[model samples]
Target: MSRVPRIRFKGFEEDWEQRKLGELADIIGGGTPSTLNLEYWDGNIDWYSPAEIIDQIYVDRSQRKITELGFENSSAKMLPEGTVLFTSRAGIGKTAILAKKGCTNQGFQSIVPYSNKLDSYFIFSRTEELKKYGELVGAGSTFAEVSGRQMGNMQLMIPKTIGEQHIIGVLFSTFDRLITLHQRKLEKLKTIKKSMLENFFPQNGEKTPKIRFSGFIEDWEQRKLGEIVKEVNRVDENSNAPVMMITANDGFIEQSERYSTDNAGKSLKKYILLKRWELAYNHGASKIRPFGSCFALTRAANIRIPFVYHCFLALEDNPEFLEHTLNGKNVENQLRKIVSSGARMDGLLNISFQEYTSIFIRCPIRKEQDKIAILIKSLDHLITLHQSKLEKLQKIKKSMLESMFV
Candidate 1:
């Protein structure tokens, strides 16, 4: 009996054919040239390693180049532009369609698909299945590696018609382009925000910022954190609000999302209540925010934040403005001085609320504060919108991968 995909494009109706990996394509391996030979090191040839084959759908260049003499001496062989470059050693099944002719190191056991039977993009899009198959059959004492023979022995379901394969390949190619576009936009927006944060505020004890709105010529006033914000210790003992924690990138997210299941039981009532636009300091250290992170509850509803977080309310300042300002390098420097070395064992910073509130902050007048807060808040909203679009696009591709493949 033959098998068919759950979903199909218009004007196509046929069960997918079963084929061994070798029948559909030739599986090949690569090797490195002698490192001591200077002749092999740098040349016009595009030479790739397993590490270079990540996230990208098509690869046209390599970090390091090799000469024709290098290729002749090594086990490495040229893979055509349309070949699917698969990493079969160290990290098996990472794949990319070669944008141009290239050769890789020993870490790859790439596939040269037959033009009449298989599509490169279609095969690359279904790397999850290949990864699973590699995991089952691969064996090595040091690190798992799939030989050419083992990879060729693997089986797959391929559409009988080359037309169907082309359609599927084109579909995935479009998806990849869209995902890459959104990702670049997201990164660009974040870069802009970083620059704005640096330039919009005073730096190095300077009274004036490098960039400012027109008609605001007065030097900024220096005020203690105690004067600009006050700690909020309000706990709702009987509250049914959702438990939350601060994430460096996403701000406040559900505690359940972090731990997967309701990890907060009897400790729920002890959680501090954070109202709209109120801030909380998460002292847990992560590479993204090494000195801890401050986040605000931008959502309209109030939620219960972990008691471990130092909660704060904006006093004589715009809430969003204060929230953005608290994450600056200046604040991180202050945090570094106060964080005890012993706290490193627990992945948490040790700094008292009194000491945190005593740090000095320079600020403009009320009108400028409101303007800065509104501008920053708008950027956050725009970022959230783009983020949502990117997530939805990814979800669509994931769903398509499941239903469109057998």
Candidate 2:
């Protein structure tokens, strides 16, 4: 029996032919122009690097463009519109088809089909599977790199007819488009929500916000955060709460979803019982997010947070409004004022609990706060919906690619 893909399109019975990539197409290597040469700097020519291939299957433009002189002076070659660009070193498995004529840096082992016989889309799909072999044969003293020769020698199970290859390529391409569309929508929704937050809340030293609901003309009252909320450090050893992690982006998430929860012989009494609607702030600092972060538990499940997190209860207040404000820049600067004047080796900020609670915050009455929070929360729901659709489409495409190829 001839070796074949697990799945096949209708009216296709011929087995795929096995051919080495070098025998089927000419593999072209790329290079960068000298940075010292000012004459070869920025121009109209599209110059591609591995970094530009992120979350995209087809590339019509490059993040950095080069001059014609740059392209000529370097080892870069002007590939045709259908050429397949595959990164060989950093971001090893990133692949994209050229939507227009372009030249790539030395990071890629691009393929120029000898004739129209090889479908660029099909080859792009196969590039994901070739990553394993590339890693196996790659060699370098400092970092692993796959050479053009190795890529050329890689074997591919090519379909007997171009018609069959087109069918499979089109199917995967459609799914990729849908995923990309949803991803763009999710980003746009988040951006809009951020704009709304900035306008709905008062800025530093400003008594009134730029935008507000009807009939509320009273200036927001300024008071110590401790006046409205009190610190809570309740610990329960026998509590059946789900162990959770307070993240910068996702707020409170189950510990098992992101990491292993193997606290061997550790006392559960040390873990704080985090009730729903309570606020938790991580004092740890990192390069990405300085001054730490805070979030209110919006999840339905009552979870147990680590003792390191500062937990507090909001009394006679809108929890969602507080959470939304904490996520904004207005509260970030207020929180920074109370942080101790020192940075830990691991980037943790030294924040005294007493000073943190004493920080002042300005807020409107309960009715206005509730209105703003409800509006922002609705946008969050829409973003989440789009994100779920994007993930589902990506998974479907991945499964199809696996079964459609050898």
Candidate 3:
């Protein structure tokens, strides 16, 4: 195996030492207190489970608390502040160093390093490395578990001086903080978009929303969908036009490498040659509410309307209104009724051209439709920008973990 080189700084040699975990620390596993005994729980003592520790960066708080009675009755041990906690099963291998005194369930093994030799932060980081090693050893097993004995026997390269360990720990902690800040920003942007979608659209019994396009005072007209537009399905095997996919969140895309291209052996010839502004629905998959299952396709075919895709996607008419309403509850219920069980496996909620066209829609003028589309599109762009930044930060963290550790 390759080894890290020793370096000298300020008249001191920083040599890395290879030693078993048991030689440097006391390995302690935990147990769950009986939930039936209410007297054991609901007190001031901090108690942690695997679920609570899985995603924690620092363990300052816990999901549950225990009393003196509970602590005495159970196998749980009160670990002091700065002890390293490592998960053992199920989600397996997550590690966190406690910031305060705490107790843990059987799912974790806490390591209390020998006084002044190893820092808690350095041990926590080493446990993370061991987790990856354990995954490789346990691959193909039905249930992978890392026993306390196995953990104690595992070997790691450690620096003799505590000062060097502290410096390495501080560097990684700074990266973790930056990643967390970007995550919070992404969450805030999502909340804003959700609120705007609800407020800008019509609500129950209010024909016209309080908000309107500038210089437009007309109330929207309620008309049957068939009167204004025609629904056509052209499912041709020979046509090589790109297979478009729809998603609930992203609307439509021309290419989808993530999904299979088979189309489930169903005939696409019956699918309409979608034009600009023409609306389409994925009636078959809408029942289960899968991601990218239902959305308006944006790319235009041979059609005349300017910004046809935006018109269908815009929050203007009752179709737009109906899209939101159907997405919530109505479509799922309606799909359940239409599903047919048979040998052909033709169990899908298909909206017929006649049935879909006959549905009534409340529509604003074309000019107002254009305006609403522009405003919502701007918000969508901002949401996408933040999402990209979050993804990039996550990638950087992953790369650092691979490079920084020996």
Largest lDDT belongs to which candidate? 1
Give lDDT tens digits, candidate 3, residues 39-95. Answer: 988998899888877656788888899999998999999998888887777677788
Model 2 TM-score (2 dp): 0.87
Q: Give the residue spans of candidate 1 off by over 4 A.
A: 259-262, 342-347
Worst 10 residues of 1 by lDDT: 339-348
**Alpha-carbon TM-score of each model against the true structure:** 0.94, 0.87, 0.73
**Ten contiguous residues minimizing lDDT sum, candidate 3:** 302-311
TM-score of the candidate numbered 3?
0.73
Candidate 1 residues 1-406, lDDT tens each?
A: 4388888999889888888989988888888999999999899889899889888888999999999999999999899989999898778888888999999998888999999988888888888999888877886546787888998998888899988999999998999899999999988898998889889999998899999999999999988888778789899888777777888877888878879535767777789988987889888887788878888777757899878888898877877777777888888888888777736565677877887787777889989989988888888788888899999999999999999988
In model 2, the clashing pairs are none
Local error of candidate 2 at residue 122 (angstroms): 1.1
Which whole-number lDDT from 0 to 100 does residue 342 have in model 3?
A: 16
What is the alpha-carbon RMSD of candidate 3 to the true structure? 5.8
| Clashes per candidate (backbone, < 3 Å) | 0, 0, 9
Assess the local accuracy of residue 308 in candidate 2 as a C-alpha lDDT between 0 and 100: 75
